[model samples]
Target chain A: GSSRPMKQTKESPNVGDVMSRDVVTVFEDIPVEKAAKLIISGSFDHLPVVSRDGRLIGIITAWDISKAVASGKPSRIAEIMTRRVHSVRLDEPIELAARTLDTHSISALPVVDREHKVIGMITSNHLSRLLARRR
Target chain B: GSSRPMKQTKESPNVGDVMSRDVVTVFEDIPVEKAAKLIISGSFDHLPVVSRDGRLIGIITAWDISKAVASGKPSRIAEIMTRRVHSVRLDEPIELAARTLDTHSISALPVVDREHKVIGMITSNHLSRLLARRR
Candidate 1:
């Protein structure tokens, strides 16, 4: 006897299931130059900023880093980090994240919880994994 | 002004010229699961594995993370991360790096120095920047 498929009213993958729950983060207090260095050395497109206790704050990206580098100085990361963050809930539909990335031409989204604390992140590359494995 | 017309000499764009001199990295000591979380949360395609002294050891990717998760505890990240790292020096021609990425179907390459320490990284996205800006 094989017990397998479970019936469900609707089917969808959620951010909690596929989203990367652990995110690379930078302290909001980190120097702008350090943040830029992380983006360059890590090859990460973007990074989330958080409080000491892991509360979500904002995000910084390579473009922002580049700007800081080009500006040369007198620019702090706090001033340049994106405050208008676009986030999704753990239970939100993956499609929501995809749409967010597509609409903004953003490559990633910070995943947050009820307290607005970032839990993970979702990127087009992660979404591509879903496509690569789905039969 | 003919001042810009300069003497004729062979010219080339080297990897160091455009490579992100900054790199995001993980210590080889980090937990494998934590590494996976980093991949997902950071929205990074690949992350360089470094030693305590910042020597380039290997690299882990989203796929590596997934496999580690799938294999469960019996697996160690050191075993899964790509050990046969294909690296390019900072001074290597960009063409060489591009060819390596294309040939291996890898998305990024760790830029190293003569000592084999990761100095930076080059990715398709960075290369895209050149095309996007060049007339």
Candidate 2:
């Protein structure tokens, strides 16, 4: 009755190893239209919002930006960005990152450093890719 | 300084307590265009794909439908629906449901009953609302 494949017991991976390092970030003051263009053209659902010194501040998701555009409202990225961003650290377990994404119902998380500087991004798509590889 | 308000110590909530009972599902054989319209009109990013008997089967995200439409491919909902659906039972803890959504990187989960029938939907937006209430 054991039809399912045995779960792998290999060494657990960390967030740093699985995170995407070619990170794309947006400034807090950019026009919402510009951010929308970046997301549509790049096929990304979320972008980390950063400060002038590159510290992580907020995140903008497709839903927020698209709704604003669809509503034909003029706005700035800061107006639409979610300020209570949930993030993961470089040295944490990927499992924790996954839990964070789940608990918040968010698809991507900004990976931060000791000073809460943006380092990388880990998305549900990335986690899906990792699982696909394992299977 | 204890600036952060005392974390609410109330009894934890369950999936059934927060789920949207009026679920919107699409048949497996429908045209992808129809699905797109439903999403666009409703402002929903995901829909539960069900069998003719209303059995929970798969899921289709706006991303999948939009990409197929954008690529000018003639496709059916069945062709675009993800077959490996992750669902939660009605009686399961909301925390477990949150974890499932997180682990899978999905925004909503189709809540099922003992017979594996589609019952309700719990989404990240709902969770965010719940958290907002707590705060």
Candidate 3:
């Protein structure tokens, strides 16, 4: 008699399982200086820029702040923030998130909902931790 | 009769295997502005600060530059760089690198030699790529 194949015990986690739920976001109207302070104080390198209705608009990073300092322009987040943001949904596979990050050369991605509101954030730091645990 | 156990086909790679060998370093005496330019022009967020004799002295990140811009002080790299930098050895395991990065809340570590000179650099980006491949 043939035996059934063993059920797989380990399944790949989704982005929601690894992402940080309590994301710190900044409004587009805020000064870049304030956003810089938030990034400096927090452990995160990127922050999602939100609209008045709490929708994801853009993303700001330490690099943007450095650029502002270097060029002495764009005092507001709306000016220096990267308008073309890449994001992932909660139910997406971790591999997809990893691929997106690697392809875009970005460190983090904001997790958005159906309404395009930022719900969480994931970064390479999270992937590093996951790899450490697996090892 | 007894049988020997099967040998493991896969082993964890070392820091040397994944690290970027061509590291970009900056001198300690250069202006923070110069370092900021290098960071902007390059794809790296951190730059190792080297002595005149090519010894690793400190490390500077985009966060440091943001701090300088926010505070409007410390124009030179020596003043703004983090003196207490954590590094890794080439022959060490990748898990150790991950743990060091996680423990210290740093994104990258400079790989050093027996003489404490920078030889390579590794970051979370590399680890992310590794994880992606394993999946």
Candidate 4:
């Protein structure tokens, strides 16, 4: 049950159409230091956290990596990742995805399929670019 | 001149009063890889770029670090850091600081004084927390 008002659109675009397909991801058990390196070197603020079987398990952000590093204690990505992640389905409307970003105060969401495998990602940057182009 | 509207307030709190005193920062001369490590480990999305004297010169973001890493080329924080940084004065109202963050599409701003040295930092997280507490 979504709390925000839905933006009505005829033949609304699905997330699969709007999401960035070249998704960047991180492993669950990697050292926090290495994960931080991947995230930093990759220039991504957030990365989809994946299990060994390539299933979406959690989500991690630069903020999460920083906390782990700041702690000065060894840690793993899984420990720092946000386990209760908000994700959008491939078939979901674009407006719903946008609403999800706003409601959660997050920049991006990993798009998943029925098997919960990440297929792509949608982010505020993409949404803003889309809006800008329309104007 | 700021492109965004300047938020007005009476008896406004200066940034120095509200900003985080323990700001996480990076040196301009540091390797991009190291900067990424600092950003990720610190759980901070942005870090003020400082000169050897600890004077603010530029700023870097997690996105910048990730890009540098993804580029797979040798780079320094100075090369990737945004030299044209948006900073707030220590005496400026907190609303102005908030507006700056909103207009810039950035998560945080480094607070500077007359010497352009970073004295503190303000971020969206702090603003949200402040609002949450007031409610």
Candidate 5:
């Protein structure tokens, strides 16, 4: 038998089940100033960058923009995107996803298909709702 | 006329600037069993309770846990927490404090601080890396 009671399973939920389906993204050629405007206007914390083919090549966030502004670097998106991204599969359990959030200390995870195409975005808020509901 | 350069201004930010300060509150008494555990987990969404504090009497988050779980809810943190919280002056400015999370929907903001309290948190993560070396 398993360690925990089979019926009383799960404490937190999964990224796929909780992440936000509405994600805002940008292209590679966009200027940093323009990207910053999009982040502020769209009221988004992060922006995913996609190639003309719709492949998620990198991710950008408002924080990155702040850093760019403070660093006085190139005012372009491509100049500061995180090519390395931590992502999750849609079907994974919430418990597993929570671990990813904690272990990585990240606020959001981009959910993707097996082909690595972006489907949705999961965040801490999504997880909190699931917890509140079961209560 | 108002303050720093109309454009070259703002440093820290606002509550609307960066606040995961995700309000993940619970009911008056939900046994605290499932609730506490739920917070430990959950991938997203801050299960907003109705009647039920739905009127917005209170808002809770995962951090409340280490507190509640440690204090023992039902046995809950409501029993020991300050009840009095420190919220932000939203619609302020990013240069306000590096101010909120400085992460995901602008690191996430509730956009309403006039309810008295419980708008959003805006953790430190939302603010860091935004300060990453621009080089």
Candidate 6:
């Protein structure tokens, strides 16, 4: 009895639609102190760690930098970066991104392309903005 | 005419309804190094800095810790804490909280009482979770 089309009702936005395109990444070989400076200088909390080929190899967060400072850990990003990085594809559903973040207890995820290169970044901040607009 | 009452249609949640009540606060005089440790040990990024009488004075965030480490700043919390803090009331609507966050470009807000004491905390994470549930 509804007038809305099925396509209109089922059009869920993909991660690419909401993810931030201006992603700032750090090289894995960079010093932790430098990484700390980069994170502190920016408004964001997470930075994707990249390889020489510009592929996302890991992630370093403000929490990781705090841990480094708190414990006086090693100097290089390789020593403190989370190597087991979780990411999503550009075409993935937003719900899947939300579930992935909830399951891993992370605030952000790197959106990779077919070549496994970082194309964008998505975070709970983006989701919050989406929700705010919905209202 | 619809049978639904106006109250039923207009019932909106407040900041107190969704904020995290188990807030962890730090005294203003505590060493910044200790606050860094506290933030590293917990899953939170922001800590409400309070006075001796437990009134919310300012906030120290992981970003602040990173800045301290990067710039080799002073040791005390009061020297580096964000003194001009923005807060929300318990009974305020969630839209107001969202607007405040958007306007200030801050991720979290401390939910305060009539005495200006922090009773709970709300962040973008809470808003993201609310959105996830709505889906």
**Would candidate 4 be rated incorrect, acceptable, medium or high by CAPRI criteria?**
incorrect
Error of 4 at A92 (Å): 1.5
Off by over 4 Å in 3: A1-9, B1-9
Give the runs in model 6 whose Cα sits over 4 Å from its true position: A1-11, B1-12
Tell me, by DockQ, which candidate is best. 6
Give the per-residue lDDT digits (tens) of candidate 6, residues B19-62. Answer: 99999999988888788899877788899998887889999998
Error of 4 at B103 (Å): 16
Off by over 4 Å in 2: A1-7, A70-72, B1-44, B47-135
lDDT of 4: 0.69
Correct interface contacts retained, every candidate: 0.00, 0.02, 0.50, 0.09, 0.00, 0.53
lDDT of each: 0.65, 0.71, 0.84, 0.69, 0.51, 0.82
- For candidate 2, write residues B1-135 as lDDT tens digits: 233333332245678998889888999888776776666566657789988888989997755653453344456888868899999887876767666766766767899988888999877655544433432
lDDT of 1 by residue, A1-135 (tens): 113221211245777887776578988877765665566455456689888887778898755543433333334578878888888888887667767765665667899878878888876556544422322
Writing each residue's lDDT as its tens digit, candidate 3 over A39-123 gives 8888578999999898999999988887786676587889999999999999998888888888988889999999999999999
Ranked by DockQ, the better of candidates 4 and 6 is 6
**Ignoring the other chain, what TM-score does chain B have in each prediction?**
0.79, 0.88, 0.91, 0.84, 0.50, 0.89
Ten contiguous residues with the weakest lDDT in model 2 chain A? A1-10
Residues B1-135, candidate 5: write the lDDT tens digits. Answer: 222132212233444745565566556555434453544354332333323434334434433332332222335434433332333456765444332333222223333456544555444334432322111
Q: Per-residue lDDT of A33-96 in model 6, one digit per residue for the tens?
A: 7888898778888999999899989999888877887887687989999999999999998878
lDDT of 2 at B100: 72
User: 3 or 6: which has the higher DockQ?
Assistant: 6
- Give the deviation of candidate 5 from the true structure as CA RMSD: 20.7
> Per-residue lDDT for B80 in model 1?
70
Residue B18, candidate 6: alpha-carbon lDDT? 81
TM-score of chain A of 2: 0.89
Q: Model 1 misses residue A26 by how many Å? A: 2.0
Where model 5 places Cα greater than 4 Å from the true spot, the runs are: A1-14, B1-135
RMSD of 3: 5.0
Clashing pairs in 1: A40-B22, A40-B23, A41-B22, A41-B23, A41-B24, A42-B23, A42-B24
Candidate 4: deviation at residue B90, Å? 19
DockQ, candidate 3, comes to 0.38
